[model samples]
Target chain A: MKKLFTGVCVAAALSLSGQAALADVLDDIAERGVLRVGVKADYPPYGYLDEAGNIVGIEPALAQDVADLLGVELELIPVVSSNRMQFLEQGRIDLMIATMTDRNDRREVVQIVDPNYYSSGTNILAPTAAGLTEWEQLDGLPVCGIQGAFYNRKTEEEFGAEIVAFTGTAEALAALQQGTCVAFVYDDSFLISRLSEPEWADYEMPLQTIDDAPWGLAVALGEDRFAELMSGMIVNWHLSGRILALETEYGVDNTPFAERMHQLFLDINPSIER
Target chain B: MDGIEAWFLDLYHTTGINLTIVYDAFDRERFLWGLLNTVILSVICLVFSVIIGIIGAWLLGARHAIPRRIVQAYVQFFRNTPPLVQMYFFFFALGPMFMTTVERHVGQMVFVSETPLLTSFHWAVISLSFFAGAFNVEIFRSGIEAVPRSTIEAAEALGMSRWQIYRDVILPLAFRICLPALNNNLVNLVKTTTLAYAIAVPELLYMSNQIWSDSVNVPEMMTVLLFVYVGLVAILVFAMQRWERAMKLPGFGR
Candidate 1:
């Protein structure tokens, strides 16, 4: 019985040590010489499929920048809102830069590194003629949005707006364009990029951002070193003006979070490093 | 390793069967709501499809050739094309035109979702009814044909009118003969309501997706979804068996 107990103890120790070896995600990526990032291929301006069928967007570009900084090749794994976290937890990807919002509830399953890379919030894009400049004014109005969005139920309950949710962004936006709803409620960052286009010129963002959330890169639980590495790279990008430049390159408007992070990064690291 | 090679290896590692996540991720309210929507959608589709089927069968049995041909064309067109494609065509292409005419007459838009004139619910019903109604036409026709020619001749000899013969002799017999096919069609229709989630109907499948996304428990949510569908289909089959027993013909399918 004593010998059997000792054998069990030895086996447990070996398995625990094996798990510890897999915990250092940063070391794993460095050794592999490739940073696999899960990013969105459906969302535009942040991440999307280009006309050439290649993944091209702001998030993909940021991930590429991270890969370059680490001297590793970038491998982008396309993910949607539904499976991004699972991809991280299961080690399918080393990092998640798929426009994942940092919510407290999500912290249970994955680790979201902060000094967030970017920020966006739910907002309404209405016809300029409607003059809906405030959230309260949406009362009794039918508003269109994508289904399964966290904000859909909130807007309905809080603002008295009727929500007409669609499965796709294209359909939801088309619904707003065709006057199926008085306004289209969606992520402000996406609307900022879309409103720049000629077709969407007639519509205007009428309200300030609601449900403000920061987009952060996430890693599997127990990968603190990897999260630290990611957060540090993000801060360096902000200080070096790379994030602002990437925004311009991608033709997306910079969020307040980016501007503030840049200011903070400059104040702390005043010395010139180009 | 190459990017594709790395991705495939990692995918293989991560996608292993894990059922614990389902227990961790289950949300009763979300699941219940999804089940409710699915039930509502299926019930609506079933009722309307049956009505359309009956009407279509009557039209197909019409004395006039053009009317019968038209009914035949509807059955042929719907049955030949895939249900998914028909749904898309109706929702995207024909839905707006129909809504435009409706709005023009009503002097206001009756539904929201700027692109579709009808709500996803209405479109689900409309598209599903037409799809199922097509098959129902054929099913009912086969049942009507299975009614004995000698029985019809006997009714005619008894000085029965065409309407009386159809109401008394043909329809009742056809109904009994068609019960099994009707049951099968209904079961298929109930299962097909899952597709409505693609159009953002917030049915069971859509709600499960939302829950899994929110909870990050794909395995758990998926397990729950599997059981929900199995339970639904089982319930339907059981109910149908009971119904079949109750409506059994005297000497049929012993």
Candidate 2:
């Protein structure tokens, strides 16, 4: 009786292990009726908690819509800027909709989807009272920034600017507000949004755009089926005019630059009829 | 005369802003605000940790075997686990329970907002204090035990009350002996406060991170950040060393 029981237990354990190995995220999400998405909740106009304390933003909204189309509920997992990819690789999230730039380095680790919706350039935000009209005016002056942002290398190599980097946007803002740096370098859209705020009326982005960088979402490599599904969704959304509708809804349509992005998306995916 | 000099001059002519911008950005008002928040967090953690440490040490140092063993288990458990894990458990797992309890009693009395009285900052302080206190309890307990039993006996024979014995005899000597360990613990506590950034308490590191993400000039920003943190920690170490030296007495043999 003991021998039979031991044999049964070993067989059962082996079967369970085999089943666990075969489990795919796409299948699991489908069965669970929820798409677990990782997003940076601190970033505004992207993924942030609304006034009502609900997670509401562009990426999260898009995630929710995607989940809805898939007939699944949306489960948003708040991720910091640094750890979003780690979360994706570790299976902590099914998809990442954070403002992750599609870089050649990152492409080695994760598969990138087509139809990058957002295009932004780096710019300098300085105090209006600083008399700084150009980037050159920031020479010999400290510039505040975030730690993991890509511009750190370029800023140092190209401009010879003294950079004071913080870990997040809020800290950098506080530093900028406190005059820790003469100027701040960040994405143009973020700079524009923050500068437009009543509290930051004193600050202005005086320099021209530095680089044309496009942003995209990333999924784990080898998940071709899931990637295809995501691409198909984007194509379908573009075709149905839903992408533009979402852009308008999120207030991205208000900017002439973003309107150009909308046209760019249409240009790339001509099959997107609307 | 060198290529580097020309490059530097060209870059300076191109990217450098006016000094007024630096002055405006690093204004005193905002620094004071950040400093105020930092000091408040430190003070709250210090007081709460000391109190918890004393209570925990007393419990562990009790004559009874069972209670002492239980306290030892607690000390070992908290000490063994990472403070970050503890913070997460407190904030995510146990936070709901605490919030519910508070909401039942005081949520109605206070204005209803999204976040309750058990704010993220409060949770950060509470978690850090308890985490630090657990280690402090062991330090204090060892110091208490190191106090010669004869000294306590003499105090007792002289008709001193329990409180008097603890206050006049045990505590002073124990504190003197534990000063070095306690100083180390205090420094650890200050550094550990950086973990509060994880829960979005807007501490120094978090502030820097936010700034970097928004600004994108990470290398320059991080260099400044490294200096700031190193400078802060160095100052703390220097101050503590001075304190330890001042407290030392040649005859006492501490």
- Maximum-TM-score candidate: 1
Model 2 chain A lDDT-worst window of ten: A1-10
DockQ of each: 0.13, 0.05
lDDT of 2 at B224: 60
Interface RMSD per candidate: 6.1, 15.2
lDDT of 2 by residue, A91-114 (tens): 888888888887989888777765
Interface RMSD of 1: 6.1
Instruction: Give the alpha carbon lDDT tens digit for every residue of B121-224 in model 2.
Output: 77889888888898889888878888999989999999998778777888777777887798788778877887876555656665555445544545755676
Q: Rate the local accuracy (lDDT) of all candidates.
A: 0.77, 0.68
- Model 1 spans with C-alpha error above 4 angstroms: A1-117, A135-143, A147-164, A183-185, A210-254, A262-274, B1-30, B99-117, B252-254
Model 1: lDDT of residue A36: 97
